[model samples]
Structure formats: C-alpha cells, structure tokens
Target: MKKLTLVSLLALFMAGCAKNTTDSPTMVGADRDEHGCIPSAGYQWCANTNRCERPWELAEVEGFDNTPQLFEAFCTGQ
Candidate 1:
C-alpha cells in the first residue's frame, strides 16, 4: 500500500539519478566518447591520427581545408 508506493517512488527517483550521471553529455570531466575523447575539453576522435584531437588545430598542422566535409574525410581517413 503506502509503503510499497513509497518504495517504488524512491526506486524511481534513484533510477533517474543514476541515469543522469551515466548518460549525460554535459557531465564535464566525466563525459567521454567511446574513443575516450572529451567534447567539453574540445577533444574528438581522429581516425587518421588514431587519437583525440581538435579539428581546427589538426587542419592547421596538416594543411587541410577546415570545412566539415574535409574534417570528416580527414578524420575518417577517407
């Protein structure tokens, strides 16, 4: 009755809290992609370099166009 409802509500609240911590993209230092890149810190996966990188910085160093298409091609090594 009331006890069961209280337990259910508590469980639901805990689940919501857990989900926020695990799935949030805005979790600062805890937010990392599958490749361990942290977007908040401006690091993204670069398949060409096989590491985390800043696209604009990489483009400058590699002498490539800074467009999104070029970045994708370069990052994907296409």
Candidate 2:
C-alpha cells in the first residue's frame, strides 16, 4: 500500500510538471492580428516598443505604425 501511494504521488507530480502548450496563451506577434505587430518590408518588429521600427531606430514606448512615410530617415513609413 505504501509503495502504491508513493508511485501515485510521483505520477501526479510528474503530470503537473508536464507543459500544457495547447492551454497556454499564444504570445503577441505570434499570429497575424492587429493586436500583434508586423514589421514592414524594410523594418523590423521592436518588442520593446511594440512597434515596427528601423534597425537603427530606438524604440521608445511606441506602438505599431503601419503608415507609409516619405523621405523618412527611419523605416517609420512602415
């Protein structure tokens, strides 16, 4: 009886430790949705600012901007 109980407890502990990928929420930018950010043709997504920015641009609490810009130094056009 003791051995059986220990084995059951161990099994339960192992099961709890197992990862539940299906039940876990998917992170932002993982899917193609407005809530997520997608970089433009010449820009990259900045997770820190949650915006699409140029490689040289510094992220500063900015959000996603899909607008097109002309003569812009940064890839803000995206």
lDDT, candidate 1, 9-75, per-residue tens: 9999898878444454555677788999988888889988999988888889999987778888998
TM-score per model over all chains? 0.61, 0.33
Error of 1 at 29 (Å): 3.1
Candidate 1 local lDDT, residue 42: 83
Alpha-carbon shift of residue 30 in model 1 (angstroms): 2.4
Report the lDDT tens digits of candidate 2 across residue range 1-78: 999999999999999999777964466444433534444334555444456555433423234243333213234343
Error at 28, model 2, angstroms: 8.4
Stretches off by above 4 angstroms in model 2 are: 23-32, 35-78
Top-TM-score structure, candidate number: 1
